[model samples]
Structure formats: C-alpha cells, structure tokens
Target: MTDVESSPLGSERERIAAYPLAEAIPEDRLNAELAALERMDEKPLPLRIPGYFRLGGPGFMGAAATLGAGTLTAAMLSGAQFGYKTLWVSLVAMGSGIFMMLAMARFTAKGQTPVIQLQQREHGWFMAKVLTAFLGLVCVATVFNFGQVALGTELVESISAGLGVDWPREWNWPIYGLITSWVALSYGRGGRGVYYVECFMKLCLLAMLLCFAACLIVVGIDWGAALKGLFVPWLPRGAQGIDLFIASSAAAIGVMDWVFFNYAGLSKGWGPRHERLARADVYIGFALPFLLISFMVICVFAGTLHSAGDVPTTAIGLSKALVPLLGETGAKYAFLFGFLMVPLTTTVAMSIVCAIGLHEIFGWRPDVRSWRWKTCILLPQIALLGAWLPSPVLIIIVIAAMLSLTNNIVGWSFFLLLNDKKVMGENRSKSWGWNVGILVQVTMLNSVALMWVLNRMGLWG
Candidate 1:
C-alpha cells in the first residue's frame, strides 16, 4: 500500500477523473469547485490556506453537533475537579476524532456515495436498517434532542436572568423550540439555504469562542499551569478522574456526528475535488474550534471554581457561580451567552441528522422541502416536553449505556468500509499511518464504552 501523500495518482486531474462526482452532487457545482482547487494547487502553500479555509462547512457542522451539552459539561467538570490536569483529554479526543472524520471525508469525496447507501450495499440491510433506526432516529432524534432542548431552555433562562428580565423559565422551552425549529427547517431549502445554515453555524462558533475567551481573560488564567495541562496527559487517581477522562474523550465524536458530516458535505455538492477542502474543513473548521472552545471552558472553571469544592455540573450552576466569583455581571453574562450557543447550534445540527436518517432509512433522497423531511427535522421539538417534565434520569442512563456499547461497533463498520476495495476502489486507504489512527480511535472508543458499562454495572468504578 502506498502512502496517501505519495500515491501514484500522477496528476490532480487524473486523480479526480478516476473518481467522478456522484449524482447526489450537482456536476456543475462540483466542476466549479474542482476548477477552484486546481487554481489553488498552483499557488504557494501560504496562498492556499485562505482558499481551503473558505471552503469548509461540513466540519463546522460536525463540531456544532458534537459541541453541545455533553462537551460543555465534560470540560466544565474536568476543570472544576482536576484543575487543568485533564485538559489534554479534550485535545486527544478531538484529534483522534478528527482523524476519523478525515477518513470519512476522503471516502465520501472520492467514492461520492452516501454513507447509508454504502453501508447497506457493503455491510447488509439488517446492519444498515438497525443503525439508522436505533443509532440515528432513537438516539439522535429522541435522546439527544431531549438533552439539547433541556440545556437550551436553561441557557435561555440564564440569559434572561442576566439581562434583568422576569421571563418565566416554564415558557422558555416553547420559545427556544420554535426558534431552533425554524432555523433547522431552513436547511436543504436550496444552495442558499445550506449556505445560510453554514453561515449561522459559523457565527455561533465565533460567538462562542469570543464569549468564552473574554470570560477566561476576565478570570485570569494561569498560563504556566494551563499550558502544562494542555500538553501533558494526566488523569487524577480514582474512578471519578477516569470517568471524566473517558467522558471528555468519548464525547468529541459519535455516530450522529459522522452521519451529519457526510450528508452535510453531500448536500454541498462536494466530490473528489473537495477532498483536500474536506480535510481542511475538519482540521480547521472542526478540530480547531472544538479544541479552543473546550480549552477555554476548562481554563475558566479551573481559574475560578477548581478549589471551591462546590463545582457545578450544569451550565446554570456555572453561570450562576460566575457572578459572585468574578464580581462582574458582564463576565457572567458573557459566559452564559457563550455557553447558550452550545445547545442552540447543536439542536439545529442534530435535527439535520434525524432528517437525513429518515431519508436514508426509507432509501429516499433527501429533500428539505418535502413534508417528510420537514417533519423529521422538527423531531427535536418533541424535546420541548423536557422543559415541563422532569428529566428521565433512568432512561438517559439506559440510553447512555446502550450508545456506549454500540458507538464503537459503528466505528468498526466505517473502518471496514474505508478499507473495502469494492466500496472505495482506488480511493481505498493505503496508508499504514491512516489505518493506525483509525485503529486507535476504534480501540480507545471501545475501551471508554466498556468503562461506561462497568461503571453502570458497579464493577470497575
């Protein structure tokens, strides 16, 4: 097997010609992107960065979907408890996850096939159906929405409180639900709609980064210690430390993230010409934003709440904690607003995932304008019920257990597809380095999942 960088493809035109664009992508649009890539490739390395960076979208969407309640909570908990010791976990997890995404990007671009179709054809109907049903519909549509909406409601309440409003928390869900549903339903409208959704996601990402960065600056970071923690891998002794490490690591990537990213690219008419752009998208658009945001979150908590012995796990708790500890309402508001973007952005991305899942399950092409597509995208609205009803803790626990066990199995399936000559053709990964990266991701995810199982069973923890 030859290295990807040194593959014997001979020329850029030949490489792209070998793997033509799939019909899902508009040929005219892909041709334009290919022409752009050719122009960029002729320039110096420094000149190409801007072109690559400008073309990224799907990666940002993946980052948005994965950056919701789970990531924020894990980063908050890690900083509050370990005080920068577990900071490396987020980096490692996201880095590893980025490798998997890069693989998916390569496969999707060169093969120009939707992941669900490839799975059904290469793996089998049973695995394909089960993955879309349980992994996509159940976990993403139901369980994930419940968590994101609940968090979105809380964030809205906190933002309202910070602004000196007397808005009732009880009414927050409907408002948040309506806003998110409108934003989510806007996707797949047309090229412009997809562009708008991507722009909105980019804005949210920038807002989050700025808000958190401002908070960290106001709180005053211990750069020496934080840098050490960022570079050095360390986990505290005992079960709690291990659990935090695993949570932060595992939360960066998931089945939903994978599905959303691949379809998001396809929706943009990406083909083999977009391969490098896809990698740039993941590394810059996804990995960089995720790492920076999680890092800032951990730093903010580490500075203020680490030794307080009363670290709050929820965003509400942390937002409330910020006011007194920092003695500045602006700082508190900044943190609240920044963190609020998490669930808001995640809800939109997850809605897309569920909608895509619905289309894939029925072997139908995605049509954002269709009643079925619009209906599926609104599935997250059901999560508004979470605002009134108590969070089903036992049910969440059961779902978490199930996802932990099955998530890695899905990773293995992707690995097989990536390696399958029949599916990938000339695009089949030949690099030992790439395979090793995937192996690490699959193995680490499996280990973390098993650890979760043991924790649930009262065996390991």
Candidate 2:
C-alpha cells in the first residue's frame, strides 16, 4: 500500500504525534491520553481552605493568646524602664511578625510539612534530623513551656494576695499543670478546641487593653510624646540587662513565631488560595499584640512607672507601679489578669508546636484526638516544671537566646522551600519576596550573634 494510504491522515497523525510512540496505539486514543496528561500537568494544586474561616471563631483568639505572655513582659519592661520610648520595638516586632507569619503560612500550605520537616527534607535528612533533636533539647533545656505556666501561676498568686484571697504556693504547681494540660488536651480535638482557647485568651487580652486604656486616659499623658515614642527609634543610655530585651524583641520578629504560625496554618489547612486570608490572619494576630503592648507602655509611662526612679524589673514590680494611678485594688487585678493570661496562652501554643515537631520526626500521628500525642507533648513540660523555679525574667532571657540561635536555621529553610521548584512547582516565591525575607532573617541572626558575642566579651552590659 502507499505510505499516505497506510499511515494516519492529518487529524489522525496530529493525534498520534501526541503519544510517545505512534505505532502501538490508536491515533484518537493517543490524542485523548495526551490531552489528559496535559490537563493533569496544567491543573492547579489543591487550594488550602482559608485558615481564618477554617479556624472558625478561634483564629484571632489563638493570635491573642500567642501574643499574651511575651508581649506583656516586653511591654511592661519597656514602659517601666524606657517609658513609651521603646514602643517602636513592639511595633517593629508586630510588623515583622506579620510578614514572617505570612511566609510561614505559605510554606505550611504548600509543603504539607512543619518547618522542621521541611528543614530535614531540604537540608538532608541527617542534618534536619539532628537540628530537630537539638531544637527539642533547646525547648526542654530553656524551660520554654514550663516557664510560661510558672509565670502565670505566680501572677495568679500575686493577684489573689492583692485581692485578699490566699492561694498556697504548693497549690500553684498542680493548678498550673492542670490548666496547661487542659489547654493541650483542648487542642487534641482539632482546630475548634484550639480556637476556643484562643477566644478565651482574646477576652483576657481585651480586658487588659481596657484597663490600660483607662489608666492612660485617667493619667492625662501628652499624645505628641506618646506618638513620638511609638514612631521614633532610640536606645536608652546605660540600659542594664537590656541585651536580653533586644534579643527577645528580635526573636519575636524572627523565626519562632513564623515556625509556630506555619504549623498553625497547616493545622488549619491554609494554602495558596487562602494567601490573602493568611495575611489577614497575621494582621489580626499581630496587630492585637502590637496595640496592647504599645498601650501598655504608654499607660506605664503616662501613669505611674515613668517617674518612678527605679524601674520595675518584674511583672510584680510593674503591677505595683500601677497602684498610684489605678488605685491599689484596680492595679492589682489588672496586673494579675495580665500576668496570668500571658503565660497561659504562650505555654499552650509552644506545647502545640513542640508536639508537631515530635510528630513529624517520629511518624507519630499528631491526630490532636489521640491521648498518646497529648501525653507525649506534655511530658517534657511536666519535667521542666518540676526542675525549674518561677523566674520569668531568667526564663525569657534563655528562651530568647535559644530562639535567636535557631531563627536563621528555620528562616533559611522556609526561604529555600519557597524558592524550590519541586516543592512549589510553578508557584515559587518571587525574587523580591525572597530578597526581603532573606535580608530580614540574615540581619536578625547576625545582629543577635554580634550582640551575644559582645555580651560575652563584656563589651555590653
């Protein structure tokens, strides 16, 4: 037969050309298979549900809770010592936190793995595995979870005393433990339970804000000065024990928040489709803390602590400063509530992230419903609680250092994943996005390391 007669015609030849080999398959079927393959390759990946909607009522609540303890400590310290002058730090932290969270959410939604898992995957399993183990050790050694619980318990005790209610120290440990355990258990059921905890936390945060606002209004502070403090940048002279402050501030803006938020984003099932929603979630989460902290610094500055020659070194001390303006009883309750809520929320959030890390490493199901997971998560904190005393400042310093050290490692991992062709396929991070993220992380890490080295050299006090 002639070649034209024996071979496929124009339409059939076109169809046949689509398949790997034209001889084996019918031309029309080959064309269909080729079309199918093209469609498969072109199809968009599954969209992650918006975390804000998926988190239901708990989305903002979780952010408020996460911001509670560290924000309080930072705000209180800033207000007591530097007055409102250091409010910029909180603003910077919150702003940076928002960006970091956005990136983290993107990674979680896209990668379907926690930061540690992504780290191991990108950096080599051995390196990533070692880093994860080291992180767990850091979490344990720093008493990151227990410290928050202890701080909360102590605040509760102080508030009780001020309100003429006595709570024994022995009772504090068990009570704090139980409360934290409850929080951890609450999350075991999935996003709703965590959201519930967050809602409760938001209420506490709102109450604290109201109290601070009232104090600010009553004290009659100069708005112009407060504005300047919030906007202007200045480092105080002869500031003692402020290196930890700077480090903590840097950490707040660095990797831990990103790491934690990404895990939360994943748990909430956010993806590229929910990018805007993720941004919104971060804005709400970040703004609440920023506002609370800024107001707190202003309240302390405009009200009682600014003129108090010797600044308060602890939450107890800062709370006492409020008595002159808010009345002893009012000040006491405000401080009590503020102190209790901060640590309670922070500890719970930290525990959840820690559990996530363990789950990824060991292939343990972090089903949030499993009793086994809950116990595994709580065990480290329990041990820490038993080993450490209630020293919030010390705890903050150590945690800050640990966070500083690891910030780059985590940040770089996210940066790499976002740019990875395999993980993100065609939807990788843009050049501008990569540059900004990398710059922020590298600057923060280097700055922290430099400060640490200087501190060790006795060049900074």
Summarize candidate 1's per-residue lDDT along 242-318 as a digit string, tens digits.
Answer: 78877787778877777677778877766666788888888888898999999999998899889987767775676
The total of clashing pairs for model 1 equals: 0
Reference-based lDDT, each prediction: 0.76, 0.56
Strongest candidate by lDDT: 1
Report each candidate's C-alpha RMSD, comma-separated, in the order given.
4.1, 11.4
Global local distance difference test of model 1 = 0.76
Tens digits of per-residue lDDT, candidate 2, 217-331, equal: 5566766777897788877665344564464464355444555566555444333334455565566555565566556655565456676687766655666566555664454
